[model samples]
Target: MTVTDFDFICQILRQRSGLVLGNDKAYLLESRLLPVARKYKLASFEDLVRLIRVKSDEAVIKDVVEAMTTNESFFFRDTKPFDQFKQIVLPTLMAARPNKQIRIWSAAASSGQECYSLAMILSEMAAQLSGWKIEILGTDLSTEILDRAREGIYSQFEAQRGLPINLLVKYFTQVGDRWQINQKIRSMVQYKEFNLLNDPRSLGKFDVVFCRNVLIYFDQPTKAKILNNIAGLMPNDGYLFLGGAETVLGITDKFQLLAGQRGVYGLTTGQAAPATKPAAPGALRA
Candidate 1:
């Protein structure tokens, strides 16, 4: 590709998804945008660029951002964070709030795995959470993915990839070669289409927000903007979950990292913090 075409792609991606594109990432542009180009019957990347530059079509813009987003995720990814939530967060929340409801949001809940995993986690401990209204809302930018999420169907391969055998037997049923998530677990979560850049007034508030792995693709400014936006929707004592390598220390002062849990952080209301940020983040894969 020519320097001009590469630069054009970089500009478009940065504007739409806040994903920074160095010249070295031209291959990434080609890989992600190739299908879009082909679908539009554009002969070349330059042709796609011409259409984008001259037309400013909203469909092209949406397709571009959707094409670039990384949708890799699984149930109970990395394991540790869920364990911590069960051992620490849940107990503390139960004790402190007592009878109050707990609300959680899985912000980048691609294909519904993470949110369902959370449902299973809570369902297992539902006895402790009785008289408390527990709700989990999962949102993604892609409507097709949300539809699949609502259907709660998964291929045998997809189901076995990250799910433990025991949980698999208990929570899923064999439908041909695929496993469909149980109705009870499916009922525990709600799915919606959301754009993080858009206003979040209708999202209400969340006690815990899991927006992991996706931020690494965003530029620093976009990352800060999203972090601040999410923080605004959360209460002062809420919890924020980032990817294993992602941190709030350098990105935004609105959140303080929790000690001992690498991907977990606490929101401090005033001068006081609930728990310390994790000192070392364990190697986690999403």
Candidate 2:
């Protein structure tokens, strides 16, 4: 691809998905978009670029953006975050929420592992949250991945990643060589296609947000904008979990690191809650 073609694609990705692609990633564009070109019956990569530039086809653009975005995820990735969710976030939210309801959002929820992992944790604590309404919403920019997440199927390798033996036995059933999460666990979460660059207020308030491992690809200003928009969707005492490599420091003042917690954050004092909290959609009664 020429310099013009590479820059154009990078700009579209950044604008649509808040992803920052450097000049070094030209190889990535070629590798990831080549299949997209073949799928569309385009003759060559240049044809794909021409289709994008001249026709400005929305479908092609969407595919290009989704293709470039990474969807790397695994069950209970990085044990500490899930541990913190179970031990800290849950207990605090349970005590504070008088309605016995909690909503969780898994941003960039690739293939639904993160959402199901949380569902399994809630299922294990069913006795404690017997009558509570718990909702888990998993959102990704790619509709294709969200479909896979809703299906809740995983390869043997996927099922084994950070998934404990007992929980695996308890929650999944083997189908051929792959595993599918039980319907009960699958029903506990909902998946939707969402972009971080857009406003999140429409999704309603979330008690906890697991936006782990997503911001490393964006520039500082994009990171700050996304963080602020997320802050708008959270209550003052709400919890935010970022990737181990990501942080809110210097990005935005809307949130502050939770004391003694490495990757957890809470809204700053000056951050104001929405006038009225909207009810979360598709809540499951536990």
Q: Show how many residue pairs clash in every candidate, following the order shown.
A: 9, 0
Q: What lDDT, from 0 to 1, does candidate 2 have?
A: 0.87
Cα lDDT of model 2 by residue, 42-76, tens digit: 98778899999899999999999999889999887
TM per prediction: 0.88, 0.93
Task: Tally clashing residue pairs in candidate 1.
Answer: 9
Q: What is the C-alpha lDDT profile of model 1 across 237-275, one tens digit per residue? A: 678888887887678888877655567777755222356
Task: Tell me the lDDT of model 1 at 196.
Answer: 70
The number of clashing residue pairs in model 2 is: 0
True-vs-predicted CA distance for residue 88, candidate 1, Å: 0.8
Best by TM-score: 2
Off by over 4 Å in 2: 270-286
- Overall lDDT per candidate, in order of appearance: 0.80, 0.87
